[model samples]
Target: MQRATVERVRVAWTRSTLDDRRAAGRALIRELTAELVPGADLRIEQRCPGCGGPHGRPMLPHAPVLASVAYAGPWAVVAVGSDRDVAALGIDAEQERAAPDLAALFPLTSPPDLRGWTAIEAALKADGRGLLLSPDQVRLSPDGRATVPDGGEFRILPVATAPGLIVTLALRHPDPGPRPTRRP
Candidate 1:
C-alpha cells in the first residue's frame, strides 16, 4: 500500500469497521503484488491528474506489470497483468443489489443489470481513465465488448464468484502480433 493511501485511510472519519475494510482492501493489493513479483521491491504510483496526489490509478513504476483494485461492499478485487500480455488490465467486483431509482436518473448509460455495469466499469479502469469519462463514453455492447474513448477497445469477461458477488476482468488489447492471442 502507498503511504498516502494509508494516511488518507487513517485520517478519514468513517467508522472503525469501514476503516478496517478499506485497509484490508489496500492490503490485498500489496499482498498480490508481493506474491506476483516475489523478492522484488514494489512501488506504486498514484498520480492524481490535477495535483499529483494519491487518488489516481495505481502504477507499477519499476516493473512492466499493471494492476487495478476496486472495492464494493465487502468485496474487493485485485487484477494484475504484464505489459506483454495486455496494455492495461482492470478488474471489478460488485455485489448484487437493486437500485431502481438510479436507472431512471442515468437512463442513457445505466446498464440493464449489475453485470453490465461491472463490465463497463472494468473496461474504463482498463483504459486507465476510470470514471474520468462519462459512462456514455464507454459503451458496453451486449457481446461483452466495450468501445472506450480514444479509439481503444476492450474485451470484458464476467464471472460469478460467491453468491451475490460478480467479478469482471477487462483487457485492453495490445498491438496485433503473430501470437496476439497468447497471454501471460
Candidate 2:
C-alpha cells in the first residue's frame, strides 16, 4: 500500500496574518503533488460538508490524490498522497511551548500535551468532520494509532519539526470511498 507524505515550509508570519501562510500551504501542496501525481490539473477546493459552502478543508478534486493543510506559528504544512494508498489524510500543527493553560485543558494522550491535541485534530480532519466530531470521541495510543469512539481509525505520526512546533499527520483506516463520488 502506498503511504501519504507530509512536508513543511517555514513561514515569515507577520502580525498574525494568515494570508502568507495559506499561500505557502497551497504551494506546498503543488510541490508534493508534482512528483506523486504528475500532469494532473489540481485545483484546491474547500467545501464545507455541513453547509456545502466554499470554506472548508482544502482538497484536490479529480486529481487522484488526497491532500490536507495545517498551519502553526511560522510553519505551513501540507500532506499529499495517492488516493489508492490511503483512505483520507489530515494534518495539524501547533506551537507546543506557546500554550500551557490550553494544553492543560485536556488530559494527556499518547504523545502528551499539544502533540496529543494535534493528533486528535488530525484524526478529526481525516474523518472530514472536523470539530463537528468531539475531540473526546477520539482516543490515541502511544504507538501511533488513533481510534474514534465510533468513527474511523487512523495511524498518526507526530513530528517535532521545530523547537516548539509540533506537526501530526494522520491517515484514515483503509477503504477510501469511491474516488469519483467524494469531492475530496
Candidate 3:
C-alpha cells in the first residue's frame, strides 16, 4: 500500500472501529492489484461518483487490469481480470438474511428483489456510475440478466462463497471467461 493509503487507513481506524472494514477493503484491493500486475508501478484512483474525490470505487487507471472492490457485513471482496477480457467488472456480497431498510437500499421490496438489487449494484459499479443513478432505474430481464436504463447488457453470475454470503459478479457481455475472486 502507498503511504497515503496506509495513512488513510490509520485515520479511518481513529474515527471508528467499524471503519476498519473500509481499510481492509482498500488493503485487499492493493494486494490483489499487486498480484495481478507484478513488478509494475501500481497506482489506484478512487473515482468519486458525486464530487470526483478520493472516496469511491478503486480503479487502476494505468495498469492493464480492471478491478472492482466492495465490502459488506463480514465480507470484503475484490474482482480482478485482464482489461482485455473485461472492459468493466463489479462484485458485490451481502449477508443472505440482511437487508437495508433505506429507500435507496438497492431497491429491495421482497426476497426475490435481493438478487436484482445485487445485480444492479454490480452493474452500476462496473459502469463506473456508482449510485449516481437511482436503484429504481435498473431493469432486470426476466431471464435474470440486468441492464442499465440507457441500455447495455450485463451478465450477473452467482458466486459461491462462504455460507450466509450472497455474492454476485457483473461484467459487460462478450466476456471470455471467469477471472478470479479474492476475499479478505
Candidate 4:
C-alpha cells in the first residue's frame, strides 16, 4: 500500500453555525479516512481536555490515525495522519487582519509575526492542551520545529490557504502508538 499523508481541506465548509460545521467536518473526515487509509475503522472522538465533556478536539480514539479539525468563519479544515508516523497532529486557520492584537490573548508567549503566532498555536493544539497549555512552555526555535513540554515535538508549516486566511499545520513525529488503557 502506498504511504498516506495528512489530507487538508480543499473546499471551504460553508456552514453558518458551529453545530453544522462540526457535523459536516466529521462527515468529510469519514470520507477522507476511507480514501486515505483503506480498511481502517474510523471513529471520531471528542473529549474536552479540561473536562470530560464531549466538546473537544476531534480525534480517532484508539485508532491508528490521528485527526484534528479547526474552523475560521465559514471555513472548516481537517487534518489526518497515521499514528505510526504522527504521535500528535494539529491544524489551525485564522483570518488575516490588520495589526491584530494577540499579546492580550496569549500572555505567556506572543509572537510578533502572524505566521509565527499561527505556528505556535498549531504546536499548542498538537500538544492537546490548547489554551490550557501555556505558550511559554512551548519551545519553538529558528527551525520550523516546536517541542511541547511533556508532549511530542512538532514540525510546524504553512499550508496554502484562501485569500485573507492564514492556515498552519503541525505534525508530531515518531508516534509511540496507543497507550495501554486500564480495564477500570
> How many pairs in model 2 have backbone atoms within 3 A of each other, for residues 3 or more apart or on separate chains, i.e. clashes?
0
The sequence of per-residue lDDT tens digits that candidate 1 reaches over residues 23-80 is 5655655565666567655767688665667766777788766777766665555666
Candidate 3 backbone overlaps, count: 0
Model 4 CA lDDT for position 111: 50
State the local distance difference test value for candidate 3.
0.64
In candidate 4, stretches whose alpha carbon ends up further than 4 angstroms from where it belongs are 1-19, 98-100, 106-110, 175-184
lDDT of 2 by residue, 28-141 (tens): 777667777789877888888888887669888868778787777656777777777777788888876664354333446333567788888899888888878768668888
lDDT of 3 by residue, 47-69 (tens): 68799778888777777776677
Which runs of model 1 end up more than 4 angstroms from their true locations? Answer: 1-17, 98-101, 104-110, 176-184
Query: Which 10-residue window of candidate 4 scores lowest in summed lDDT?
Result: 1-10
Query: Which residue runs does candidate 3 get wrong by more than 4 Å?
Result: 1-17, 102-112, 173-184
Clash count, predicted structure 1: 0
User: Order of all candidates by TM-score, from best down to worst?
Assistant: 4, 2, 1, 3
The lDDT for every candidate, in the order shown, is: 0.64, 0.70, 0.64, 0.70
Residue pairs in steric clash, candidate 1? none
Poorest 10 consecutive residues by lDDT, candidate 2: 7-16
- lDDT string for model 4 (1-184, tens) is 1112333322223344665777767876666676657876778888998988987788766456777777776667777766666677787777786435777766765554777777777888888889788766777778888888888688887776567777788886774669999996
